[model samples]
Target chain A: MKANYGYMDGSGEYYITIDTDKCMECSEHFCVKACPAGLFRIIEDDYEDMVAEIIPNKRQAIKYDCAPCKPLEDRPELPCMAACTPQAIEHSW
Target chain B: MVTIGIDVGAKNAKILILKDGEILISKYRESGFDQAGVTTALLDETLAELKLTRDDITSICSTGAGRKAVTFANEVVTEVSATSRATFEMYPEVRTVIDVGAEEGRAIRCGERGKVEDFAINEKCAAGSGAFTEAMARALELTVEELGKISLDSSASVPMNAQCAVFAESEVISLLHANTAKQDIAKAIHDAIASRIVSMTRRVGLNKPIALVGGMARNVGFVHSLNAAIEDEVLIPDSPEMTAAYGAALIAAERAA
Candidate 1:
């Protein structure tokens, strides 16, 4: 199960993709701690399974909130992605 | 030379006209659905009041959330840059700026020259912004001003549990039904916002001589909450809402020169 968060705007497209299938296998939720903006959280879904989710309010303005970490030249590794031991998190810029 | 700075804020559009480093006039109007239209009308009205025309202005700069909507601006600056610039110009000793607007909150760490070294923003959520207090005030059947004033009289501290505005509204109503003092609820609301803002400020590293800008600065209760949370005296300009516009004007002056 792939969960997508964020939206595209006049500035650019930003998405934080989470592979829930891979996420469920992992016990440590590092993405929640790695996000500086506190935009990530773990929530129990309809299936009563714990999954990582993006805070609903941050979905629209992810571009601005993540702007500081975005680099102009080379793509830098994101802390949230790096922290995910299962490599379940991905960011599309 | 005359320069005009326009801040297309979420709730209002503020315009500041500067003539040779001195403020000539400042005006603010509610920003309706059409930000560009409101800004243009504001500029026209200000220019008319000062007996000046657009051509007479050496430069025009725009800042705030809808800054890009102002098509006539010579340049567009971010709210962080503009607010820090204005705050630093007024109080050179200010090293940190906490701006809580209607829809957003920002904490900026600046150097001695007012250049932003680091910053954090809470734009997506309304819980920590002025809108939270406004919503809570509506729930309490009190005006925003009255809410702030009444909060000062609160003797007991109440804690707000909700982190979202929607949830907080219900919490406020429940408190009201439970016969919780309105003053205590108001204080709780301010304290909640203050704690969120203080945590955001800590992200960029809090420095001394902090300045609080934006419309929230006008709320004495919120200011007191921030002061208590940060455990430091926070400086506020005469017109807290106009800081971004003033900074934009300063940038326009510099660019025109």
Candidate 2:
């Protein structure tokens, strides 16, 4: 289950996508702690599985919220993406 | 030397003209869908007021959300760099800057000489920015400025549970339906934003004297809430919205020199 958060605007597309299939295999959820904005939260799905999800309030504004981290010249690896050992998080920038 | 700095913010376009390190003139206008057009008009108007023209400007720099739209700018600077530079210039003792604008919030930690050491930002969430306050104010049937003043009269703590701006609006309406005092609701809104700002600032490590810039800095209620949230005094520039433009102008001055 790939959960996509954020939307596209005139500036660009920004999405914090989480692959729940990979997320369920992980024991420790580091992504929850790694996000400076506290954008990730753990929620139980209808299937009774716990997974990481982007907080609803942050879904629309990831472009601006993540601006300090995403520089134009040389985009460094994102902290949340780097923290997820399962490689479940991806940013569509 | 005369230089110009333009800040094309999400809601407003601000321009500053610096003459030999002093701010000669500053102008602000609503962006109104066309950021570049509004910015050019603002610059031209300011220059005309100063009896100058674009040719008189040694350099032109731009910053903020719509900075890329400033086609005529000689350079563009990041908001973090520009804000820190302007704050440090005004208050040399400031090591931290908390800027809450209409659409975003940023906390910057700076080293000596206003170099950005670290920073944190809350951009995607309206609940933590000035927009949240504006929405809440509209729900309460109060202007943004009126909301700020009324919040100062709040005597009791009314905690707001909603973390999302949309949810918070419904919450405010419910509070109003339940006959909760408007002053308390206003305080709750300011407190919510202040707490979010404090947490963001903590990520960068707060150091005093911390200066608050951007449009929200003018809100007395929000400033008080921030001071209480951080348990420390925070400075405010004379014209908080112009900090970014001032910093950009200063950079242009440096480049010209």
Candidate 3:
């Protein structure tokens, strides 16, 4: 039997999953480089607006969201799946 | 049996002539809006060199980044169809095919009998592509061929941020200013590009016996880093860039048969 897979034309079914805990302190964010679809981008979320960055000796940092290399139907076979060195990124089936 | 295939891509064109499971002639050329004229010229040139007429060709098929552009061809197939067909023909054991070009890159999964079962493509960016590599090489005052050779010599890893080619160029310039080693920078770029390809390939679910094709496949550094990143040996065709065209020709032959 032939197995059916892959995204239909102009539509895709893969979603990028990030283990935020693994990404919190990682430096070599290769996910930003590996997605040929231009799906991964470094967007620094402002914690000050959401919460606050200043508090004596508090380890406060903003969140970085790694998205699909491009926008498609719901999602894409995310190019970030294998790029994360810490195994922090995944693709939802 | 004779068959012809044409691949009209964003940055280039490829033509192939095959007979009885053998490639007789192949040509690669740059493509433009006037694809018909360009294809005619290339065909005439190749036919003249091979001492054959267009009538000698029994069937025609087209594929590539611009498969739909070959209006004069007998049939136009998806690059996925043609890539899987051609890759399986050359290496029947191949389960994965990675095609990287000037404009985009793709990962394909093929099953038995050379059928494409799953695939992923990146059509949006110049980053992690042949064109981006070429542009970076020019910025570094190096040729694409020399870049790979020198990149392999690096002893350290230089960090590069920026997924866009434009931003990557800025990052490269900054790295130069920061006195980062050139070889290290080169290796870093390869690593960066490898990161993207690995991500895409993983989406398609990398299995064993991966084959790489397209113009960027000619880069030894890419091959090395890609192999290292994935920890799998890569299979590249004798003429790695022409695999897509050959696949198109194979489809033409199949249809004729």
Tens digit of per-residue lDDT, candidate 3, span B30-119: 888877788888888998999988788888898876776677689789888888998998899988899998887888989997898888
TM-score, model 3, chain B versus true chain B? 0.96
DockQ of each model against the real complex? Answer: 0.08, 0.08, 0.07
lDDT of 1 by residue, B196-218 (tens): 78876766767787899999999
Give the range where candidate 2 chain B is weakest over 10 consecutive residues by summed lDDT: B199-208
Ten-residue region with minimum lDDT total, candidate 3 chain B: B120-129
Candidates' C-alpha lDDT: 0.86, 0.86, 0.74
For residues A1-93, write the lDDT of model 3, one tens digit per residue.
111112222223433445555555566767766755344454343431111111221111001122223332345544565666767655434
- Residue B137 error for model 2, in Å? 0.7
Q: Give me the overall lDDT of model 1.
A: 0.86
- Model 2: per-residue Cα lDDT over B164-225, one tens digit each: 78888999999999999999999999998897787667667677778999999989889989
* Poorly placed runs, candidate 1 (over 4 Å): A1-93
Enumerate the chain B TM-scores of all models. Answer: 0.98, 0.98, 0.96
Model 1, first chain, TM-score of 0.90
